[model samples]
Target: MTFTSHARVDTDRPARYLKQLCSHFDRKANSTFDEEKGRTDFEFGVCEFLVEQGALVLDLTAGDLDQLDKLEFVVGDHLERFGKKDGLAVNWKRD
Candidate 1:
């Protein structure tokens, strides 16, 4: 199943954050990114990110039903890393 959330981070360099994310997961998983295109994909149900609407739209697939909570943790952790944009809160909620 696929789980997803949109994090509102009004940063001028959203692509930069995406690059950092791709780099963070670099040796551990299969990841690819095209910052110029503002898109990134990661394997093993990690997450796929798209920079849009002043937010980092995220789609994460839980390999199994039991992985839902784990997926939330991963999402929450990463969103935190991206930090708040313009002091705007980063809220993770079901899409």
Candidate 2:
């Protein structure tokens, strides 16, 4: 099974930062973050774009993606304040 999550990008830096966080999660979870999974799935590539665009910055980690409980709310609040995204997405799948 595969799960998907969404994150609204407000700025470039924050989005790129979040992308990096996602890349780290992909490495940790041993999963591939396909473009279909998200519009931005690259690390340095996305970061470069964000940097060129001048984004504020927001790093969305895998842990903040836990939707089992109130993790979303907790993480959302922090990201909302830290990053330029309105909200975040947490995708998960069962094997």
Candidate 3:
């Protein structure tokens, strides 16, 4: 079965982060993104990003719980690092 999780990260520059993440991941994974939305396909899972008014929405899917956990950590860790200046954090809810 597929596992999924969602995270809404509040940030002033959602578009900037989205673009940065997509660009960075593109080097290693299949990533496609614009200013408003992005998607990255990893070997274990997929992550979809959306830039909202004041937040970045992430929808992640994986083949299993282990993959889902890894996806969360990988995406959240990178995003937090990129937004470290703003004290960004990602709190995900499983679905």
State candidate 1's TM-score: 0.66
Q: Model 2 segments beyond 4 Å from truth?
A: 1-9, 34-66, 70-95
* lDDT tens readout by residue for model 2, 20-54: 54465455343233322332232222211122243
Per-prediction backbone clash count: 0, 4, 0
Best by lDDT: 3
Ranking by TM-score: 3, 1, 2
Each candidate structure's TM-score, on Cα atoms with residue i matched to residue i, is 0.66, 0.29, 0.98
- Total backbone clashes of model 2? 4
- The local distance difference test score of each candidate is 0.59, 0.35, 0.97
How well is each residue in 21-74 modelled by candidate 3, as lDDT tens digits?
999999999999988999999999999999999999999999999999999999
Tens-place lDDT digits, model 1, residues 33-61: 78633333434356667776556566566
Arrange candidates by lDDT, descending.
Answer: 3, 1, 2
**Model 1, backbone clash pairs (residues 3+ apart or across chains), number:** 0
Give all candidate RMSDs, comma-separated.
3.3, 9.9, 0.5
Q: Give the C-alpha miss distance for residue 18 in model 2, angstroms.
A: 4.0
Q: Please identify model 3 stretches exceeding 4 Å from their true place.
A: none
**Which residue window of length 10 is worst by lDDT in model 3?**
27-36
How far residue 87's Cα lies from its native spot in candidate 1, in Å, is 4.8
